[model samples]
Structure formats: structure tokens, C-alpha cells
Target: MAFSETVKHEIMVKSARHCCVCHRSKGLNIEVHHITPKGQGGDDSADNAIALCFDHHADAGHYFAGHPKGSKLSPAELKKHKESWFSLVSQHKIENPKIASVEISIMNKDYPGFFSPVFIRETTIYTDRNSMRKMFEFMGKNPDSYVEEFKARFPQNDIYGKHKMSKIKTYDDLMEYFNGDMEKEDREKPNTDPQPHKFELSPFMREYKVINKSNCVLYLKLTNGDKDVLEDYKLYLNFENVIEADSVTKRSKFFDDYKYSYNVFFPENNRGEFIPARPVLVQNDSVTLDAICFRPDPKAKFVNLNWELFARGVFGSGTIRINIKSSFEQHIRERHVEPSEIKPKFIRILPKWNFE
Candidate 1:
């Protein structure tokens, strides 16, 4: 029988990755020894195993083979060492500990593209003192002032849906909950209460003019109108009725071949670099995205371009809509009209046309 990885990890965490007898970190040589020798009817349980360094495994004074007669540590003494070490580790963890980040994907079953979204959030295992107290209280333990101090420093949000709080008995259990493997209800469900955080899109101008007949630029300002600061909010942009033109023909004869080509840029820098449509952080009362550049095929005629912006945060989510009218003012030489006519007939036309 061998100790499972899960049990081994739990023991290691509780022991602070050190030998129970000598209090030495196992750099390259760590062994899990059975307190009651396996030969003497010991099962491979966590309570029956103790982590030891190479020196402590063979130390004559603490652990020895064949029942040495002189001052050797009994199984009872090893159990005491394991208990004391785990307590020390737990106390140190309550004082100062590293936190784990968990990312959960939330999707609206009705709206796949618009509603399905994933958010990366840090867990409250290390920072939420009140949560720890709640766990202890659930276990019938009296919580001390340390829990209050933790609650003051790191506040917990109600955005997380109802969780099985009583199941969390230790810090490891709290981490396991965030890792998404617990036998609990849906984790992505929003709270029953409405969140106060709000987001809005503010267009810089109502209309934009196309430059060089083929290129145009527009700006939309994203503002976090919420009272509370929104952390790690993401912005997404969608464009419609835009297509890419072929370099060889300079235009596509078929309408299906034409696609939208555009770029987004930060107005402050304007380095001519295109910002990929990725998630961006929007602080409370701060503007996130400043500008967007729209470039269409040179051969395109008058077309109405549609733009949609979506935003999601810990508190709430919303969408904004924008429309841009693109019309070409330049005229190209006519091939059907005779050169000798008093004036060649001029008409608004798109270089690319589909013959039906």
C-alpha cells in the first residue's frame, strides 16, 4: 500500500515541507515513513505517515531499525512531533500566506458569443479573515481577533454564488473549493442581489469622416460609472460589414470576399500600433479605451458599419452600440462612356460588384 498524492500533498502542506523530527527542509531527499511499521499492521493513511529528511530517517536517537535498545523515539513520540509541527504550520499560515488565483468561465446559455465569458479572480483563502472565522465557527471553534484583522484588510464580495461554506475545515479545503473540484452547486451563478458596478460607452463624436477615401478613424471612451472600484473588467469589440480586399485585384468582384479591416489604438500614445481586441482593466471612474481606427477596402462604396462593445466585471455587465456611415466622395474614370461626349456621365459606384 502506498500513500496517494493527495494525501501526501496534504501532509506536506500541514508539515510545512519539513522533517517532523529534525525540522529540516527536504531539499532533494524526502521520505514518508510509516509511524507504525507497515510490517506491524499499519495502513497507508495520512495519520500513519510522517515526512522525514534523509538524516532523520536513519538517526539512531530518533528512528532506528530492529528495535534498538537505547533512547529511540517511540511511535507515540513521532505522533506528537507530527501534531506540534502541523499546528505550528497552521499558525504561521494564518499570520502570513500566499494566495492562489482562480479563473472561472461564465457563459449565458442564451447568448453564446455575447454572454459566454471567463474571468480570472484571486481566491479569498489567504486574505479573507472573516471567511476563515466563519469556517471555524461552522466547525464550532471560537475565532480570535486575527480573523477580524483579516476581514478589515481583505473584504469578501458577495458576487460569488452560494457555496458550501461548512465543508471548508482547513486552509487547504478553502483552496480546493476555488480550484473547482468540490461537490457543490453552480459556481458561476451571480448573486441574487443586484451588483452596483456599472459601465458605459461614450462616443467621442457622432460621426467620422473617411480619409483618403479608404481609411477612417473613430473613438469610443469607456467609463466605469460604478461607485465601487471594478477590478479586472474586460472589454470586447465586434465589427460587422467590413472585409479585406485582395492585393492582386485590389478589390474583390464577389461581395462575400470583402471583409472588415480595422485597428484599435490608444489615443494618448497614437503610436500607430493596433491594439488587439483583448480584455483590459477599467478602474472606477476611469476611461479605458480611447480610440479606434476603421479602414475599409478602397473599392468599397457606401456602407453602414456596425460596431458593438461588451464589458464585464465582478459586479455587473453591459453592452454599447455604435454605427458609422462610410461613403466615398471620389469618382473613377468611366469605361463605358464615349470619350467624345460633351460630359461623361458620372455615377456613384463600387469597384467590386456581384453579377447576379
Candidate 2:
């Protein structure tokens, strides 16, 4: 991950848009360089940032000890220059915030110069037997894609090799296979609930696809609102009153079972609107499927997901709130043997940041 917009903006102001190396105002023709390279265990923090004119930045960036170069900028030198320039800027704070500003380069990006201390990206989903049936029905048209997506969501049961999946095409046959597999797992790890999992599917799928033991299953989004491509980005999640992120088997943990998620979701490729979430590629200024299934504190009216987006050129923290206390309780009440009764849906997919 790289310096966040917050830190970069601060560095730009502290240096008064001047490259600390040359000590001359270069406006937006400057790049913030890390005093100590990230490879050397440096972090994307304000203290590690130094503004350098594009020309000096190129020079300071390239250094080979094997071929001793002229005036190679060292970490110590960068710190000294940054401190000296910051002191000078403080002595003479520019009256105009925009004059000789480094952020002019990003002006067209409509960069939100300041971000909220906490960003709340919230959503809710409601599921019951009918929703499950609808989910499967939606997936019936293309069982092959379902199998691949199902594998991504539940790798443990994806034991059916691709070569064999083509043989099992119908939705009913797929469910039967899953139910049998569920029994297989039950035979290994006996469950106190219904012996065969009458939901018409396997225990593995039930555990993840249906939020039977969790408050709700949701799809979260990771957005690169900036035009810059966020390279080597990692999205980390901290689940409060959420389940642990350990896998019982060698297979990767399922959505509801995972606390540490690095997977991406692509709805377009799969019948995403009707199926569960899973995937992993990203681009600049676009949105993709990227989130969750959880066994949360059901009693808590709202479960808060503390998330950190770490990527080169960007980083920040935010919370995705899933208000579930009432909906979950209602679901528990409606979870009876009746197809006519509808389950209360809490599909709180955030409108502000969803892929249309």
C-alpha cells in the first residue's frame, strides 16, 4: 500500500508544493517519494514522505552502489531536507491555499481533498427457504457457471472435478449431489440438526449459502474513486463479534467462515444478481463485487465491519454497517415449514456505491 490521500495532501502542503530536494516550488510537477523504500520495511506514512521535483525525483529514485553515482540521496539526507523545508514553510505559511499547490495535478479528478474521519458503507440481505429456492432457480439456467462459482464460494465441496461437472447439469441433480456431499460431511462431523438437511442441498452449501447460523450474508464493494490505478492493493477486514477466520480443512474458508478476506467478486461473469459473491480483478474508478458472509452477533441490532483498503497510491479505513437485530429475529420466527410465508428481506445493499 502507498501513502493515503490524507498523508499525501499533508506532505504537499507542508512543503508548500516545493520539492524538498531542490527547495524550489515545482507546483504539481512533483512526486512524493518514500524516505526509506517500502522494500526496506518503510510504510506509507506522513513521516516517510518527501516532496521531490520530477527531475530530482528521477535522480533520487535511481541509485546503484555498484556504480557509485554523483549526489545519491540517502534516507538521512531526505529526512534533513524535508525537516528543513517544513520549518521554512512554517516560518512563511502561504496566504493562498492554492497558489503553488501540488494538488493542481489532481484537480480534474475532483479529489475529495478531505475525507470523513469514518466512512460508513452499509448493506443488508434477507434469506429464507424461498430466497434459497429463488437463488437456486436463478442459477438453474447455467449449472456450469454455478459449479465454478460454487467452487469459489465453497472450495471444500468443489471436489467434483470440472471434467465430471459437465455430466451433472440440471439444477436438481446439482442439489442432490450437494445434499449427498452434505451427508458425507455429516458422517465425518455429525450434526444435531435435521439429518439430511431438508433444504434440498448439502450441509456445506447450507452453512454458507443460507445465513442459518449468521445474521446475514452480504456483498461488499471496494472502490478506487481515484483515477490512479491502486497497485498491489490489499483489502483487510476486522469483524466485530464475528466468526473466526480459520479453515477446518486444507480448503480455503467459505465466505461466512472467513474473517480475513482478500478475494474479489465478479457478478457479470456469473449470474451474480441471483448467486452468491466471489472474485478478484480491479481497475481504476470502477466497482466490483468484493465481500461477505458472516456468523455475527445476532442479538446486536447492527454489526460493524471495520475494513482497511491498502494499496499503492491509496489507503484508508471505513465501516460497513449491517443492521440485523430485528431482521435476524424476524428470520428466526419465519423459519418454519411453510412456502407461502415470506421471509423479511433486509437487502441493505448501499445505493451510494453499488455496481449498476
Candidate number with greatest lDDT: 2
Clashing pairs for predicted structure model 1, backbone only: 242-259, 242-260, 243-258, 243-259, 243-260, 244-259
TM-score of each: 0.26, 0.30
The predictions' CA RMSDs to the true structure, in order, are 34.1, 19.9
Candidate 2 residue-wise lDDT, 1-356, digit = tens: 88886787788778877888788766547788988878777789999998999887887786434436557787888899999889988887642133210110111133243111111123233223334456656867444456556656765654545544444555444554543533343343422221111123355555422213322334444555554555555554555654322111112334433432324322221111211132222443334333333444333555565554544434445555544442322211122213454445433211111111
Clashing pairs in 2: 123-348, 124-348, 264-279, 265-278, 265-279
Residues 112-210, model 1: lDDT tens digits: 222111111222222332455567779786655433343345445213433444444555454445444454454434321111111222385332221
The TM-score of predicted model 1 comes to 0.26
Name the lDDT value of residue 247 in candidate 1: 16
Report lDDT (CA) for all predictions. 0.43, 0.48
**Candidate 1 Cα errors over 4 Å, as ranges:** 60-66, 93-356
